[model samples]
Target chain A: MKPMLAALVLLASLGVPLLAVAADPLASPGWPIAQNRFLTGKTYVFDDRVQVIVPRDAEDSTAVPGFVRVQGIPDVQQIMVFAELNPIPMIVQFWPHRLEPNIGFRFKVQQATPVRAAALGADGIWYIGGAWVNAAGGGCSAPSIASADADWAERLGEVHSRIWNRGDEGRRLRLTVMHPMDTGLAAGIPKFYLEELVLVDDADKHLGRVEVHASVAENPTLTFDLRTGGSVRIQGADNNGNRMLGEVE
Target chain B: MMPRLNALLGFYALLYGSFAAALDYQLQPREIAAGVYIFEGRQEHFTRHNGGNIVNTGFVITDAGVVVIDTGPSRLYGEQMRKAIATVTDQPPVQVFITHHHPDHFLGNQAFADVPICALPLTQKIIARDADALLDNMYRAAGAWMEGTEAVAPNCRAEAGKLTVGERRLSVLAVAGHSGDEASDLMVYDHRSGTLFAGDIVFHGRAATTPHANIQVWLQVLRDLERQQPQILVPGHGPTATDSRAIRETAAYLEWLDTTLREAAAAGLDMAEALELEIPERFKSLAVIDEEFERSVFHLFPAIDQEVLHGGAGNGTR
Candidate 1:
């Protein structure tokens, strides 16, 4: 019985340290973990032959990091990513996959978060890669052009989309909207936000939707995947009785 | 495993803390030149506040009227510029010249609609298509900074070409590559003082931010401006640099950027590696150099590489 008691005490002692460690909220997770969630809906898969490149230390633009080679994509159609909370959360997504397996673009990052890149391969698989940015400030929530709200109201229906045809059944489409997509965080003259609901549809079918927080950038430019030669349409409506429409060519 | 978790937690704490402290820095406008003024816009280091100082608008008080060059960021700012001008001059500006089509430079044009606004033909097209977006950006940006100010699209419009205002003869040079329809030029050739307002074409202090910039054409334009050798050169930003030395300094910075980027491209350096390089010593004193310099370099390197790859002459128009 005495030996049993000692064993129980020992077990309790070991368990106490584990509990202490678990209770510490400040513990670090070694590998960079993305706080942003992976979007699951229609999957876009592409070839791994392409490479995604950006600045390593974005803050210190002088330090150029190496290009991250993307693999496992079948046929790259649209390669892009979006900051869920950036002024323009749709960071960048290229359409009609180019022949050169690699492309580069420079973007203003706001804070340290996981940056996810989605690639739609020729095989129609949506593959994603993510990286952590040390960027701190977000540009989407910042002030937009002063006359943005009024102009957005006037030209809200002027929707335009351009599609680039890549040979061999591959295509890219770039869609832009004139919406003030106020994130409900800004304080204006009368102390109100330009609240609105925006939607993207392909042939009257909903592809993706965003519940825009105040962080979406002004004049949101979204580039996404549509099979080459596929016809699409986009529409947007604001809570303030504003609406915009666009047709893909 | 514990160490990795600790590191991750440390990073998160730092990030969240910094984000919470991302307050809007006040944008201060300073009179950088004699007849030239610059509204150095606010730059939010961490948050979603990205709009900084827009175009540098200045006026030369000629005997007949004032020659206003470029407009502010929005129609509201344009109104502010007008009010600012009213304080200095009795008569309103008769002729306005757009230095470029960038929103900050020309978006506020509507306030000056009554005046004969002029710009390159390409600038007109860009403004027509992008005016709404420009105004949206201005409003969103101003709401984040100053109180009660709102962004308004400019109604004033103009076309690109050569024009004369009173005794001041101006030439609109179609300089592309920075933006789709960017027009830089030699405005107001004052025979009296011999000052040439080289808007964005001549960046006196450190390198200018070139996100939508065409490095090759921008460099060539700098060389062309240097060839002209105006006595007093007023840049788009920074203090008015007197003499040809400012022109030389601007040229030297471009040359250095060209050389450095060329070497990096040849070395097969990626964007990240290229950005890591140390900036030259000459630009240390300039404000926001550390923050904006790398972005400038990253933009120029690939742009220069693409220009070389196309086998196009570095000095091609636009």
Candidate 2:
């Protein structure tokens, strides 16, 4: 008991989620057991309010599609996605000005990794959602299409949004932005992509959001699980001063 | 365990489609001219949703039987095309003409196995060479749509000349400059109806794909095609055009792309800078313009840059 207490004190001082890991030794690595800038030192309870969708076997490693949803939370300010296997790790770090609900997006999954999404609330607590993405080869270094292609600039900043009721009392919202989420791995290619995405309801109610990473595929896509069904408003920004707003009924 | 579960679910979906809803390949062709019928495919890229049905395929009913212009993207599309043709005319397609070696032009040859699917010898050779890689990419882009699709090479050789089909005289010519399969992309000029079944050589509304285009040579081919002065020109991808002015539209685009890529390469702008280069406002209205231009620049611009500046023997993704 003395040793355990000492370890807890050490972990608390280190600002890690080691206490959560210590509470359940059998917990998966995805159960928030590491240090995060937004999640460190904050008392966060494990809640199903945040959910994620990851493909078990992604056919195209370069564009592994996934979705993250955050609901039943108030005043959410930011969200971040991290792929454990990526060389750079954090896929996206979003600072959405509008409180939009959820996002479905594609990731440049380098290899098989435990991908996690962390949502930061106004109360300084981060809710986490995670899944495992299995891929055969490297999605990061495969001569990404964003930087190598010359016509990406003309098509940049175009946004397409769609909303559909899953019919299981849950609605889904998907948004695709035409921007090369460059990971800066390729020679001569700069790190350019959507940095943040925010979702809001018809009443301008703040919902779930996420920050994007360069590991995201070109023409970034975001899908979200909507707890409440109605008109949805999406807002996102990129490394370039490009802001796009979309509405889906 | 997850993949196993997914595999099991896929098996069940295959066995019992009623449990899970899937895409239905319902193809219906519309008659554009007398005997020349065209199927306007979905105006989208090859994806899981579109199921690879993104190529314009037409069929002409001759006195002997039906002559198909180009098979679609997959065996399923070709099979459905056969069924669609049966609804229009009872005669089966005697000769299936593959316009080029593009998968959209040949992969559906499996559906017309009984018929003599004909193409240029070079086209056949390139298709034979790139069959495996092409099918692999197609399967990756379209999962279930390529289930039964197999790469079936064109068994019959089609020559450049007036082909006598029963009573109709159809003049077949080669137009090579659009893509890699040089001298393989063929055009069929119907003398009776004044319709030109122009393959990938001419893109009307869609931004032409320029993966292996010799733009200068392509320009020359367009001028020659315009000289034919066909009443209707059915392009490989988009809607059919009635006037020869469509040829100029395609030529202008190719010339612009060639000039832009050369200029960018000469200006020491790398592929990254070239990608960010401004697209002229005129080509913005073309269908799939963004995606098409990006793909062309990715595959072509860097090589042009190297050939012009670096003196390196650049590699072009074939």
Task: Indicate the docking level reached by candidate 2.
Answer: incorrect
Model 1 lDDT tens row, A22-140: 11121223211212233333433222344444443454211123233455555556555554434444544444332322333334445544445666667665565545555435433
Q: Give the per-residue lDDT of model 1 (tens digit) for B38-132.
A: 44433222223433343456777655787777765655556677777777667668877776666667666667878877766566666676665
Query: Which portions of model 2 miss their true places by more than 4 Å?
Result: A1-249, B1-22, B311-318
Instruction: Give the distance in Å from residue B128's predicted Cα in candidate 2 to where it truly belongs.
Output: 1.4
Q: What is the interface RMSD of each candidate, in Å?
A: 9.3, 16.3
Q: For each candidate, what is the lDDT?
A: 0.52, 0.73
Contacts from the true interface found in each model, as a fraction, amount to 0.32, 0.00
Lowest lDDT block of 10, candidate 2 chain A: A19-28
The Cα error of candidate 2 at residue A116, in Å, is 18
Chain A alone, TM-score per model = 0.49, 0.70
Residue-by-residue lDDT tens digits, candidate 2, B1-318: 999999999998786674235555678888888888988776667888777888888888888999899998898889888999999998888998888888877888988999998999988888888898779778877878788888888999889998888777898897688775357678887777877889888887888887567777788889987886789898887888998766888998888888887776554433434445677899888888777776676456545643543234444322
Q: C-alpha displacement of B209 in model 1, angstroms?
A: 1.9
